[model samples]
Target: MKSLKNHISLIIALFTVLASVQIYVAVDRTIAAYETRLKDDYSVIVVSNKAFVPSEFKSMSSMIERSEPISTAQVLDRLKGEMSQKNLDLLRLTLPKFYRIYLNRYPSPKEINNLQRLLQRNPAIERVEGFAQTHDTIYKLMLLFKNVVQVFSIAIAAVTSLLILKEMRLWQFQHAERMSIMALFGAPVWLRSAVLFRLAIVDAIIATIILCLAFYVIDYYGFLITQLKAVGISVQLFNFVNDSLRSLGIALGISVALTFMIVIFPNEED
Candidate 1:
């Protein structure tokens, strides 16, 4: 039972580290998806003295994906009942050309400023509305979320790594007598440390398998998808092939490093 508990403890530690990293990955992807949606829906309105060409704006700023002219027909229709046909036609002809320009991706505050300045520099453009305030608020919030997740994941991984080392040390002590006896009998260090490496690899694989299976179940059930939909966004929470491989790699790496550390630096008494 004690041996089982030890194994379980190591597995749990490994699982916690893997879980923290996976959480960070999931949050980062979700934020990226949200940003993509925002980019697709967001646009800048430009008022120009002359008709605007999308190619002209694209040439001015690589960020500009395309532009569409805003129709003034509804405004003219609204005035038809009150004004004569000639007056309406004259007003339509004199109206400044309005265009909605889309960008390929969301821009940072500095980029927004640059785009506004670029548009305003054009002799034909009368005004550029980039919605700076709204964009800044959303951008800052997303950045804060990403930073928090990163810090949290790092903290968890650090603490769990210490726990993993402590567990390894305990295992080393438990096996010290056998190791010492082997050394006295002319057994090499690698041969004596083989059991520790085996244990490490076994526990790492177990932890990775558990993590992958848990996420696969969560993904299959669409729990994360439902939660995101409630918030009006969609994210790809997990890719079994990629994420599983990544988790396995991390687990094995940590296990191998800590095990090697313990084997290389045994207690001074040894």
Candidate 2:
């Protein structure tokens, strides 16, 4: 680790390997969870849980008038029955208050026109409208995140490699200018690419390990936080060490890759 550029390169390599893994896991988990929630919402729609404004009826002294709050269950049951008779489609249901989404046509567009008719005729019916959701927004955001992590990991690996290369080159030149000697020996240019590939594979392996640990830590912290919240406790300083180490590892790997490239490939014409 103390060795000049080589050690520096090694550190960076380790980081790239770890950071890639971490990103992979995070993205995977986030997307998976998001989809799961969406599915849950679609299958189960709850009626509005909004309590009636009690104060508005404050002047009504009659006990019966005061007690008759709007029935959330009644509204949902009526809506559901209407939809059934009309053969309408519902996309999802949400919340204690306002969490029901109706689809004009579901399962696909072919059935939508017919569904719409059913909804329009119902007495409890509100005007039905078709909706187009923005898939591109979600796609763009996910892609942006992926690119950022990729760049971070690559940069760390490259910088590390560059530093290592610089040391080796300097030593070679000082000892007896090995760069010139290699030219004389006609050492195939393939060597550079080969070395880079080796470094990449090594970095990938290290990154995978780091990623596994990252998920583990995230799981631990996430679980603890969830538990604390359930018990009605609040503690902030939640996670520092694990996150820092992960970042450090990524930065170091990128540096190594940069150093490796610079050292392996010389700009000077021999």
Candidate 3:
């Protein structure tokens, strides 16, 4: 029952919802890819520097740090001192901060027995959990938060898109007669084709841009974006889409061409 012009907000809102869904998927995928690459590089770097760092550095560091919270300055100082006992590999590889210097030798039961005898006496050494113990639970929790936001964003976007689409269709029905009459008239093939192609293409381009910008605002501007850390996510997607703009151009061309063909060709008594 609504006029199309009267429902401009609904159309725009639909675009916003679609864009938000796209932005969440794109950004999460990008971040995951980035993290994977970084993890690989970090692992390689850590591995290469292992010889210079103490074999039991993680174990030993845990022992010492049990007495106090790890001060970055103190940790780095300790690392520097350990790096002084250089071998060939240690000399070549650079040690990075927070780069896990694995205790290459897993503690045998006999070694553990000895370590317990020597170290467990101190109240500061209350517990000696392996690095895996600390990293796993915390890492999973971080990952869970990251995924929850993305999922929540998608759900909200989907619901908004459906609502807006419903509102937009109410507006669109008002134009149905005009569209049917255009088909009824003997509109020239070239004119109809060009008009339809232009209309669809222009609308698609406008939609894409609006979608992209809405996504950015949803991510970056806190007021509009209720999702957590969504700005960072949106910005990342913008960068990705911007980088692959050629794809958009190609898509536009294909869409316009297809629309032109559909409009120009005779079908169903038009």
Q: Candidate 1's residue-wise lDDT over 9-69, tens digit each?
A: 9999999999999989998998888888789888999999998677988998899999999
Ranking by lDDT: 1, 3, 2
lDDT of 2 at 155: 71
Candidate whose TM-score is highest:
1
lDDT by residue (89-183, candidate 3, tens digit) is: 46334432333322323333454345445544434333443333343454456467568867877787667555543443443344445555665
Error of 1 at 4 (Å): 0.9
Lowest lDDT 10-residue stretch of candidate 2: 60-69
lDDT of each: 0.90, 0.45, 0.46
> In angstroms, how far off is 55's CA in candidate 1?
1.1
Stretches of model 2 off by over 4 angstroms after superposition: 1-5, 8-10, 13-21, 43-179, 191-204, 213-265
Q: What TM-score does candidate 3 reach?
A: 0.41
TM values, all candidates: 0.96, 0.38, 0.41
Q: What is the C-alpha RMSD of each candidate to the true structure, in Å?
A: 1.3, 14.9, 12.7
